[model samples]
Target: MNKEWFNSRAKINYFDKGYLVICAVLSVIEQQSPLNSTYR
Candidate 1:
């Protein structure tokens, strides 16, 4: 019910989305090139 709580929750959601996006990108890269070391 507080302003600060809402702000932090928004930030956390943004961070989680960013993390998932990165994971998806990595998965695609792995699929394209399974021997690539870029993700490692």
Candidate 2:
């Protein structure tokens, strides 16, 4: 019910989405390059 709590929740959701997106992009890049796969 509090405005501050709601704002924090929204921020967390945004960060979660951003993190997923980064992971997806990194995976795509790794798949495209054989060198990157060796690091993992």
Candidate 3:
């Protein structure tokens, strides 16, 4: 209902989406290289 509340909610949602994306990318990388030696 308030401006501050809406802003915080939007920040939380943005961070949550970013975290999910990072996890998905990490999983894909791991699957591609189980040893994780090539990327490093």
Candidate 4:
């Protein structure tokens, strides 16, 4: 697929990696943080 092609051919961007890491960390916090119930 086109996505696979991009993965093989494109240069990785540090900004893109940082964004994904931030998103993953936020998801873990939302799932397990003590403040989760406070928000809901």
* Model 2 regions lying over 4 Å from their true place: 34-40
Which is the better candidate, 1 or 3, if ranked by TM-score? 3
In model 1, state the lDDT of residue 5. Answer: 96
lDDT of each: 0.86, 0.89, 0.88, 0.77
| Window of ten residues with lowest summed lDDT in model 3 | 31-40
Give per-model CA RMSD.
Answer: 2.3, 2.5, 2.3, 6.1
Error of 3 at 3 (Å): 0.5
TM-score of each: 0.74, 0.76, 0.79, 0.53
Off by over 4 Å in 4: 1-12, 35-40
- Residue lDDT tens for model 2, 1-40: 6999999999999999999999998888788777577666
Candidate 4 lDDT (Cα, whole model)?
A: 0.77
Who is ahead in lDDT, 3 or 4?
3
Over 1-40, each residue of candidate 3 has an lDDT whose tens digit, in order, gives 5999999999999999999999998888888865566877
**Which sections of candidate 3 miss by over 4 Å?**
none
Q: Per-residue CA lDDT of candidate 4, range 1-40, in tens?
A: 9998787655467667888999997787798868666666
How well does candidate 4 match the true structure in TM-score terms? Answer: 0.53
